[model samples]
Target: MKHEFTVTSILEDARKKHDALMVLVEQNASVPFLYMDRDENIRDVLYHLYGWHQILSDLMTKNPIPPIELRPGYTWKNLTELNYKIKKEAESYTLHEVKHLFNQSHNHWMSKIAQLFDHTLNAAGLYPFTAPSNLGEFIHECMGGHYQWAIQTIEFHLGDPYLRPLLEGFKSLPEVEAIVLGGSRGKQQGDHLSDYDIYVYATKPIDVEERRRIIGPHVSLMEYNHQFFETEDDGVLNNGIGIEFIYRNLDDFKAMMERLFNGQVNRGYSTCFLDNLLTTKIIYDKKRAYKSLQDTYRFIDKAALYQQVIRQNIPLLYGTQPNYFDQIVKAVKRQDIIAVNHRLTEYFSLFFDTLFAINQINHPGEKRMLEKALSLPKQPKELEKTVGKVFDNITSGDFLKDLEQLTLDLIKLTK
Candidate 1:
């Protein structure tokens, strides 16, 4: 209820955060969290925070209270647009200038605030623009809120990238039975964008926390179980290496080997597991377990396998518009551009797999799906034309005829 209490409480939180940073400087002098989301450096983030303060400072000097717009012409109403603007403008300012602007703006705003009457701040409808919150509460959010953010940003910059170090330590783990490297890295087709497709096979469930600890404050975000049954996904960049981890328990995998590795049609996962077993180059296998995987998949019933997938999924490929082509039509008519694209994409994906099934081809993962399809022996003759039409999501008569013909051609290949 007291004006002094509101103002003092806000500053106390901000002042505490500032004091903590100063104490941190006494021990370790490394400036914290220079890197932010999607690898945006520290200077850019400061520029964004400082922009808000600068606007508040300008309004307070010209008029006691500011408008909701924050600036005369533009406002932070559209946050995504505001972030875009901040990023573009911040590029023009040096890191030093950003710091100076922030400091100057902070002083000017605080000085102006100190001169205001407690009644002018506390009384509602005084500033008709910011109705619900009078003025002190607004300043609290701008000042103390942003200071806490900067301190946290500094803390986030401390960790290293975690993937490479984690894999390096896997060699010493007593639980791990095999460490096999696969995907482009194993197939000798790896480029800069290629991820680490490493399989860490163990007899029991791999200890996740212990794996994270080996890197020791290096990992910022690590995700698991979304990609596969037992796996971890990390996009955190460290030492310029992008890594993806797959953990397979031998006790669990032994059950899946006959179905997944031997080309038994998996309703959910598809046939790429056979491709992985074929292409993987084992790094460290104490019992040569991966060799058995290769041997099992080597003599597949290619004709029988092709019949299984084609029969199951071909009905999906050749159905009428209400079932097949009409899905895209419904989305396009609704003007749901994302839905239109999604429908087309899902159709194309199923179409690709069906074509491979006809060829009895062990389709690799999505890395070079279309390219791989083009190389196969039993694919549709007008494949490139069909691919272009579907991918473009073009709803013309010629495109329709092309898609229909392609579907008919694929059905023939299956037979």
Candidate 2:
């Protein structure tokens, strides 16, 4: 059996419709308004989606033989309630408050997911279901398909001019490799007006910088890297740089798709660029294709730790730690299941400790202590001015001094 995966067929109609909508929206000063309003709205919607899935996963875990009809209740009313709660939260905030609210809401939802997964595992006494299967699978499906839809929707609403250039550039890559789009936009938004975040794949490493030069003035190339990996007893795998091109060749395009389907190659990390999409540009040789699905999977897992540090630790250091942490602790302590659910307790507790450690490390004069806490293998030259510049950027000198006090306090507390 042959599986046919065509990016054009999947995206074309939505892209065209979205472009029309963007044209309409751009008539007035609605673009910025849409951008601001839609950003939070989309995030709220995704949280609700994730919440619905978490609830359903929990329900299924609690009862192995539950009726399928009960699933609707888990989604509709629950999502509605969450939507209301989010709206209410939004209402109480000033303009400055909205930025962090998104992060807080996301963290809360992720915590709920963790709890739901824990309960599910405990109830089943085994991992439930398989890939592209189960309640989580439903959520995954929503994330993959609906997310793209949302991006298209946003693009239609905003009518941003970047979409055309992105599409044209995508058409220019080689024909056989895979293009995997990742980062924030790839994960969330699904609209045509959105900026394109694309990763083009190739069998042999191509000249990414040269391609960027060819794309020229219309596209703005942000960051590009040529990744070369040595395969075990096989030749090296060369991937071109990140490009914002205006055109692509047919052969290069097909090659990109084949490599993508085979999981032969990939682009770099996508944490920053939230709106990117993979184009599957070229496949050099079919039989010589490499397999990297496992590697991609592992990278995602490892990336979670980095995300945790960013989402939880860095935010805490930045004075954005939710006061809800204490509330969570109180709620967990009140629950009779805490002692029985040692794993959950331990996991959250470790997360809490890490958060506190990060806070302490960022405390004033902590730069001196960072040398000790980080325990880097090599001792680089001290750059007090550089450290000071970073401190100033994040907070005033007072915060830096407070960090120093916190570090001393931590040392005493530990001793």
Candidate 3:
């Protein structure tokens, strides 16, 4: 509840805390989050803060301080009824709508704050409407204070049992700039089979021994410095939950994001890191650098990147001499099952990149491709059925021809 009231400090704190809360909201929105201290879900918390943000905007902009109510017939004193109405109204909205409304109102309120001078913000009675208290105080309570409360409230319900102790141990290392919960767990879509995919963003590498020493107590089985893909530690928590500790240099990760923002496109998995960052929950951020990066690129326009992703990946699917379709044809001709599977995997990667681009959604990583695609607003009809058929008949005589038709169907959707 404590906050700095200086114009500069309050503004920075407001933005930082807002970004943190947004990340938290995104992480927990998919799951049922009922706060024990109150009868509220995540949407209730979001619309509650959003309602206050709207009030703050009105208070700052309206010259004579127009009458405001918690609802039509309610005042601030009718707190319980006010909250009930708010929650009831929010029940009609989807999670996406509530998040959008909250985010937009915050931005609008911040813009109003930008127009105020320090004297106007920090001095009492300068704005007689907020008498006995300065605008800065109201700003703190509405924006920063309210954000912290919402964050803590939702986090209270969504806390992971093993995450707290793990974060405590990792926080001891100076080299760890930030730590995040990534993959399905971070996205709030994890089932029983899902693991805790932890990403450690560091200034420099934490020695393997140090990592082992830190994570050993919490994990039953631990593997150190596995370079199967990224350099990471593989472990199973004492509670029998699988967790991965993947290391990344903070600076290099920033550079990768910069490249994506500037339209650098990979043949496949073009926006994997972008999706990962947006979906991650900041378990430990030592210097606040990770949150800053999240704020910078959170709303980045990926129109160009999407086009580049489709352009670079779609061609490789077919319609070229050495395309995936042709490669599959040659592999099938040789009756090489391994080669066929390899080409099929690459084919789907390229296929999905184009699919996601055309739909204007970030690629949601490697697992559950058909499910992810099917969830998108726009996608080829019978997509899952076709994909299932291709895989089931991978050894059938018409495999290459079936794949070509599928590629052509996907290409038609892009056009």
- What lDDT does each candidate get? 0.63, 0.35, 0.78
User: How would you encode candidate 3's per-residue C-alpha lDDT over 277-345 as one tens digit per residue?
Assistant: 876877777777887787576655668888788878877888877898888888878889899899988
TM match of model 3 to true structure: 0.65
CA lDDT, candidate 2, residue 398? 32
> Which lDDT tens digits does candidate 1 get at residues 92-205?
987667767766766666666666666666777665444566667667666777777665554544323344346568767888888766788656567778766777887776
Clashing pairs in 3: none
The candidate that wins on lDDT is: 3
Query: For model 1, what is the error of residue 105's alpha carbon versus the real structure, in angstroms, after optimal superposition?
Result: 80
Model 2 global lDDT (CA atoms, 0 to 1): 0.35
Ranking by lDDT: 3, 1, 2
Clashes of 1: 4
> Could you tell me the lDDT of residue 281 within candidate 3?
76
The deviation in Å at residue 261 for candidate 3 is 2.9
RMSD (CA, Å), candidate 3 to true, equals 15.5
